[model samples]
Target chain A: MADVGDLVGRARDGEPRAVARLISLVEDAHPRLREVAAALTPYTGNAQVVGLTGPPGVGKSTSTSMLLTALRAEGRRVGVLAIDPSSPFSGGALLGDRIRMGEHATDPGVFIRSMATRGHLGGLAWATPQAVRVLDAAGFDVVLIETVGVGQSEVDVVRLADTTVVLLAPGMGDGIQAAKAGVLEIADVFVVNKADRDGADVTVRELEQLVSMTRREVRGRSWRQPVVRTVAAEGKGADAVVRALAGHRAWLEEHGELRRRRVARASGEVEAVAVQRLRAELGELRGGERLAQLAEAVVGRELDPYAAADALVAELRRG
Target chain B: MADVGDLVGRARDGEPRAVARLISLVEDAHPRLREVAAALTPYTGNAQVVGLTGPPGVGKSTSTSMLLTALRAEGRRVGVLAIDPSSPFSGGALLGDRIRMGEHATDPGVFIRSMATRGHLGGLAWATPQAVRVLDAAGFDVVLIETVGVGQSEVDVVRLADTTVVLLAPGMGDGIQAAKAGVLEIADVFVVNKADRDGADVTVRELEQLVSMTRREVRGRSWRQPVVRTVAAEGKGADAVVRALAGHRAWLEEHGELRRRRVARASGEVEAVAVQRLRAELGELRGGERLAQLAEAVVGRELDPYAAADALVAELRRG
Candidate 1:
């Protein structure tokens, strides 16, 4: 097997196969993939990652495909990481959403890949941001990350994106569900996909009410998020969506929001990477023995879990 | 107005008022309360923290009340922390599930306290295990933690408990939802609560099938997770639930699982405490001018969040 460094080098040389292989290595949880990804981080600041999230059947894939097509037409290279929620029972079965974007897959200008949640607690597939890094370092102008609609954790995607577009379906619910899930605050742009559906206007009105209420709560924020309606399948509102995104890009540039977002993204990436390292190093040294002993003790009830965890950490630190 | 140390002292001296005050202090997120609780951990090993988690309205509160009644009847003192999901609109709301357990509140032998999740990501209220530690140190024979049921992240409760009872309601969409949520694996004992409802037997059969399938997939030495049917409102099958818990306890004891459990609990608690300390320290230091500038940079998009976090941590270490 080629070492991670070699794969990363090939990826930096703009080899798609090398980039794909590197991502697979990281996704498979190879021990040295982190170092390779970290080495490439300095070269990764150029690509703007846009996260597209929404409920299933809300045309997130279609919207993404349209956006990819538009970006390609504009002579910019694009990469799509379509995140699918894994089937809990048969972990092997993936809800392959890329099939919907089949038209773009064959385009040399657009690179699309599907990622399963792999049963991780937080929504974005664990390997997602790393894959984005690979694409970014390989000089993609834009990388789009589409998440499977698992409510709150979906908010996590915002940490990984320059801009987040929350796709909404008309006639879904009273918008209370979205509010309850904390989706309203995280969305940079709200897209009412499937605009041809009934209640699109109502949905937009409700969303506007939500935005107004948010403004009332937050106050003094000049950038009021715009809600755009689009029939993604017919591609009627694709330009508006693209325009709204471009407007956001301009706003970020005008207000120095891009630099701030890059900092936030970099800080989040470092923290995540650090935490993963800490957990792995600590786990390797003591996790197996401590877990076995702790599981047995928990089963026996002689000591409580809190105490066991304390002992494990203490031991790890002592070592 | 009494300090946490004083309250801990009073509670240790068998004063219920002091114990209640100590619990309140912990719940309020007072920094001193953690120190007081840690001082009391050595005296808390005797109480068994039992975690109850399941889907919303699965009668977890009712089951908890019934189990409290049973334990009280056996002359065991019990502490109940009923965690409710907080309303996103209001940060403060009534922790009012006590109405369901009204019969036990004034029983003297049963101490029932309602807790709100308070925007914590984990299902159990963040203050839950701390409160459990307070109860344990106060001489309660058992501490019961009833989580706000969102299904995911309830696994955090496993780290806080000696035994985990997963409650399931009849006709909850064919048990697929339960399996999908990954609740079935963490359960030490499965209680088909609300057995009086129709399709109870079918739910039990379905659960059995799912559990069996999981066992086959993992294929190792596994304990047969016993399922008990309960009509908690009527107090039927409450004895069976207790017996099942007791049986698991015995199994753990015979196989030396108790010691292992104790270690695990201790280790988990220690890690949580360390993380809490890190967060507190970081929050304090981030109030400085340099960190403020860094935050501005992050907000401006010049620095990524990952790098900002890294710098913040580095600055803290320097201090």
Candidate 2:
């Protein structure tokens, strides 16, 4: 019930409660929260958003936690937005991800939050990026986003991250199928997580082959994607992963890809916000009578959906 | 080099070459395609868009072909939009789904086309609903959209379909995991495809339980969510699937959900078109400078993506 402006101001002034409240407000999809988000936008753009995605149970959470620790050890602030699939029946997230980050909860330099898909069709809960924006504005130096590894939609994390790391476990069936599905191309760096598992060598070989296949297709001569193997639980390969990330940042700079990615990221966010606004407006305009008539026409095969949509849009435009 | 308007006109006249040309024009992500699509919109709304989605190798294409056959047998004309994952290497779709419908290509009443995701970040290819509109205007009574089962983004099917059937194969790891992931809730009718496989009954029962759980959460009067078992290869349960669809149509009418779905569907199409248009325009206006700048800032860690995006939008507004 607090004024959103005041809440945003307090958050900018380092009030943790205000940051927490703003996150909840955005997550709830409250209309007023958009204004708060917009106000806080000016203060964002300081956090390094790293996307962590892989097939389910690939130790994505463990990797995220390890990264968080590494980031903190380097004397940098860290934020984690762990995305979990929601339970449709209860409309609540299992929230198991936060448990993985238990060590960092009490650390002032760390902020960890778990987000549910929240009925958004895409793997991302619509509010996930908005929440990320809030943290960035709050001065977090590193933001790690963990997606439920369901594939393509999960790759959307790339649009929001400065660097995207695709995690893969050893012995997953059909490695080519997974790569062919579009995940392989989105990775700035690949991590063969759970390397202690049997057949890790085989998975590594398959990933290398897939990467090679992708490299041949790329038009440019400069970009070289690297696949790194990691036993995330034991932290055996965390330093290499970090080094690969740093190398990617350097490559992005040398090639100017980082600038392009930032522009694309911005464009994506603006478009998302614009679409959400349009959907809300359209929903309000669809009065019961028009909807019922259109439904009847569709059921009776009297009108096609496209025609119905034209009529509705025409009506909206007229008003 | 023909104008898009001319191509769309030819497509409307049932010229296969024209239809194919128009689809290519749209897929090319050209600005003129919006005008061409707008011209085609008036003829759209007549086709019933049905969406088919499930995990890979669940036989979505086979099931789609069977449905098309049934609809054609009933003297209804059908249009098929099969969206294949783009080959990451070539940025072109393999378009092999037509193989599944090899039996129906020559049927006068059945029109089948395959669409590649075409670098669209979202699962449903950006050109999809527009292609469906073209098909609708071409006088197809039913439009079936088959999406690669990559999850979240594919769920966008529900936004585009009057009836959405989620296919599930028997023994797909954990049925409860699938159900809890929100796929169960999007389905109007649950299908246990590959019913001949072991654990079919178990999958069916788990789906029923999941649906019942959702029903309880909504606190609505108890109504059983129907599950149809189908071995799509042999067409053993195609008729039952058809009947279940009809039943869902009837239920929608009774509950007014059908009308609601139509409005939602129409609005969704409009939003898709509007967003696509806006993105194209934005792309042209940026002319690659803004994107390049943002991507660079991201790599340098000099700016956070969210803030950079907010700034870009501000800059765009100023321009």
**How high is the lDDT of residue B22 in model 2?**
72
**Candidates' lDDT values, in order?**
0.67, 0.68
Candidate 1 per-residue C-alpha lDDT over A48-104 given as tens digits, one digit per residue, 9 for 90 to 100 = 789888765677777887788778878888988766544332232223456667787
Worst 10 residues of 1 chain A by lDDT: A86-95
lDDT of residue A225 for candidate 1: 77
Instruction: Please give the DockQ score of every candidate, comma-separated.
Output: 0.14, 0.15
lDDT of 1 at B288: 40
DockQ of structure 1: 0.14
**How much lDDT does candidate 2 score?**
0.68
